[model samples]
Target: MATPQPRRWIPYPPLISVCASLWWLSAAAASVHEFPTDGTVIELDDASFERAISAFDLILVDFYAPWCGHCKRLAPELDKAAQVLAQLNDPITIAKINADKYTKHAAKYEIDGYPTMKLFMHGVPMEYTGPRNAELLVRFLKKFVAPDISFLESDSAVQNFIDMAGANFPVFIGFGLNESVILELAHEYKKKAWFSVAKDFSEEIMVAYDFDKVPALVSLHPKYNEQSVFYGPFEGEFLEDFIRQNQLPLTVPINSETLKLVKDDERKIVLTIVEDELDENSLKLVRILRSAATANRDLIFGYVGVKQWGEFVDAFDISKRSKLPKLLVWDGKEEYHIVVGSEYLDDNDQGSQISRFLEEYREGKTIKREMDGPSLIGFINSLISIRTVYLIVFIVAVLMVIQNFSQTEENPQFRGIQDGAEGTDASTSHIESCRDYQPVNKED
Candidate 1:
């Protein structure tokens, strides 16, 4: 009984060491998976979301869900965009967050759908509604990353750019002056056109266009061999007006070109039906329309020389006996005289007549006939044209209509598919739960 038992120590099991090693390896793999290995796109999460977004001048974020089919399809487009954008002079950062895993980030940006792409510029976020193609993405990203204005001081720089540009885009060159304001236009129309500033003009450049001043704008369409010259006080609103006016044709003729212009334009077309193509009065009408056009870019100014095209005059119902230069407007659906009666056509106050016409149109005083507005079929076609937004609206509207029809008098208070959604109290618990993560403004 007194025999002391030899002290025994249980040998440590091998499984303990093996289990610890597996746990360590798992953690290492998780850390690696948390970040994107490729440099094209950055992986963001709740912790680094704000800082990462704020670091870039312009960053496009893809709020995606793993199980979403649309999200999976958009992944390749986003990766392609990221790679292409990576090569820009000033690159735009393309990043993504797994909204399904990071529900907080999804809630922050109000992500109700998968693959929601937003362009955040200097902390201000704008939803991207453009096409989801590589070409459109490149063009769209260039809007945020492009230089405001490129200066071409030497003839070689100007010539090289113009010649090498392949005449695919319109080239706007400001000669003999370097105004900072042009940069504003450059930013606005960067995606639509190319802009450059030249402090001095070469003899060849000046000889091509008839401009004598320093602040002259030359709109060159190399493909069409067309050039529009504008000389002006190029510093303020006037400069902006000049740029806007030159961006489109001053007066579009009514024919094949007119059909394309009208079909493409969603705005009301202010058309002057002239009996003569080169008539002085017809030209005056065009000039007046141009003056009006300079202010209201929403309205397109065009002239139909109906003398040769009598069928068009009948189609628009323009009276030949009324006046040589009769003014009427087409809503891209039906044509109506600018003035209800023909008296205003020859009025000495031509500007006032046009102004009155526009004012009446804007104030809803101008009556829109069944023909003046889109027909039922045309309206349906137009609805389809705005597919993404209007399609959703149309579906919702149809559902509401069906739901209303399905409801009976017995349950008059029935609230269809939306049921308690509308006018229901939204819980503030989410806000309360997220309060800790919210950034507090120091001033508050």
Candidate 2:
């Protein structure tokens, strides 16, 4: 009929159809997901999990257990984060599932530990290894909702981008540079860092980021109050290497989340084990570690708190009896080195101790030791410390010995036999003979 009606031709039927299809798609997209406006962590179960994941463009789901202390600590932070994130134009949903209760769902996602976070973007899942503090977590999650490479037309836009980027993740801004230059990197490292191009920015902005050249790419670690500028050669591995190295701050705190970052890095870790990472002494030591890290950019300087993660500390053979603020160079695997002379750091001379340790490490003057046990499993399942495990074994052995002795005493024949064996001088004679016999050295 349309062909026959060609004489009364309908102009641009395809264009009309395409316009109608686009309108339908836009409506469908709007209807497919209705983001929550409540700004509270949505409690999810097996039944609603899939629906929720498909309903939001970006969602951070915490796979948690009811009795998990870490999960409990994370709840309030998540709550605060939900409130802040919900207000964004493209809201990010914060949700949790009791992995313990919903074993099927947990197994599907490979959630082996408590409070494991996974971010779902358009139905694809990736592990969420960002900061846990409420404000920092908000900043970290914002990266997902942001454009891969933001184009800033004005200086005000640059300032707004930086202010909005926050301090959780490093931000890269290309000044007087083209988007095509950093496009690939922006997409590659988008999850770990923020990347943008400042189309219009003044020298004052350059001074703020500590760069003096045009067509410069500046990397900012606002959390650590650090910034570095790279001039040109932004085509290949050189640009990537610079960006990769700067993903983490000069010194990173070793935790479950940050540990993921450290593991991905090729550099060895200059690990400092402290009594409490939040304590004043530990903070001061972290600053020293940062200085060392600055000097030796090839190595990652990290610190973990014994109080915060005792099992991890135990893996390094550190205990309450051991010296405080222990320094070791970890290969980020099973083996680590303790400098022979500078094994333990003195609180008074921590800076010197760290310098000496690093010096000895470079000079190959250190003792290499395997971690006490498999640290990942130990971190998750070791509710009690290694010392506690030993103590329990000791107590059980002592109790078994006492019970065996009581049983032997109750058995008259066994007691008489034991007494006879104890009274025998034959055992004593054998011991004396063995002591008198010297071990003969054999010729190779």
Candidate 3:
């Protein structure tokens, strides 16, 4: 038998190619459109900037000069960040305005820099002081975007979801609820934690967790065998507090699955390096670290045991000559610091040293260092991966389909099809309900 050959690529006709390119270019334009636009970044000009700002609850606008090298460098990162945000169906919009070309508009926004960034919340603009990278940008934008929440309706589905995510993510399950508020919550903290709503109460899991009331919140971390149950009053503010309290464990094993949780929302990681199972002293430090972490939700607490995570220990540059247990803080950027001596952790009163360590860190006393590679670049690379080819193919296929069904004199009978497409586009702009949501029975 002969080996199969790859399919040959064919070019579109000149007319159709030009039409598709123009259509896509218009769709990619920054100006607000009646129809939903595809792609990562929206290119805004003076005409579209104001409407685009007011249209979204939160919008991140990049004011960039065409000739500036810095602006050119940031463009790709901004594009990648927009792609990530678009995937989540997040309300946050990433848009760019050509400051050099639109001097009047740039002056209006007071963009004095080549690549200045401003975040608009409810149409009010504020300067963005965060890092200029994809991960940080994504993390920063998500802060403004509403949380993405998941709703699970049945007993088996709820249990299975909990069991599945329990090992990786800390599962926050709200029981005996069918309100839109929970869905709203899922979007609010969607970046920080995983949330689920179980409309029908599960008798077995409820008894297992020992919850007495309806509309209660339960957090279960199957990895550590820890469960926290909250009796409601599940109001928005109250539930937000409940979620922050139980979103993460005090000390979790740092692995591929949990690495994301440890690094989510651009928080600094306070990792305690141990042998395998934590000993008495390590456990005491974990308790103190948990207390510190509870107060400082900005920090993620985790542990890397040597026996299980030998590579992790070496990744931190810890040698065999070093002590068995150690503590370190990594900001995922490039700043990494270690607790000077094991005695520093064990010498002081129960929590005093760690407190001072955090204080010193805030005081800018911690020694800055670098990792083998930056995670942000790794993430940006992932975002700008081979998906671009697929995206172009998809766009081309869509354009060809539309062109094939064009309403020429030969296809006069299909005139309604073109009109219906236009009507759908007009109506789609207004239909803002949760399209991802499904009926409870649909899950089963």
- How well does each candidate superpose onto the true structure, as a TM-score? 0.48, 0.71, 0.41
Candidate 2 Cα errors over 4 Å, as ranges: 1-48, 64-87, 95-98, 131-137, 274-285, 305-310, 320-326, 342-356, 374-378, 382-444
User: Mind giving the per-residue lDDT tens digits that candidate 2 earns over 239-337?
Assistant: 998898899888888876677789889999988888899998788888888888878988998889988988778889886798877888898878999
Best by lDDT: 2
TM-score winner, 2 or 3:
2
lDDT of each structure? 0.68, 0.85, 0.69
Deviation from native of the Cα of residue 118 in model 3, angstroms = 34
- Model 1 local distance difference test score: 0.68
Report the lDDT tens digits of candidate 3 across residue range 294-345: 6786677777777765655565666677665566788755567864442245
Residue 38 displacement in candidate 2 (angstroms) = 6.3
lDDT for model 2 comes to 0.85
Candidate 2, RMSD to the unseen true structure: 12.8
Report residue 94 deviation for candidate 2 (angstroms).
Answer: 4.0
- The better candidate by TM-score, 1 or 3, is 1
Q: What is the C-alpha RMSD of each candidate to the true structure, in Å?
A: 18.1, 12.8, 28.9
- Alpha carbon RMSD to native, model 1: 18.1
Q: Model 3: runs farther than 4 Å from truth?
A: 1-166, 176-178, 185-215, 229-247, 277-288, 315-317, 338-343, 347-356, 359-365, 372-444
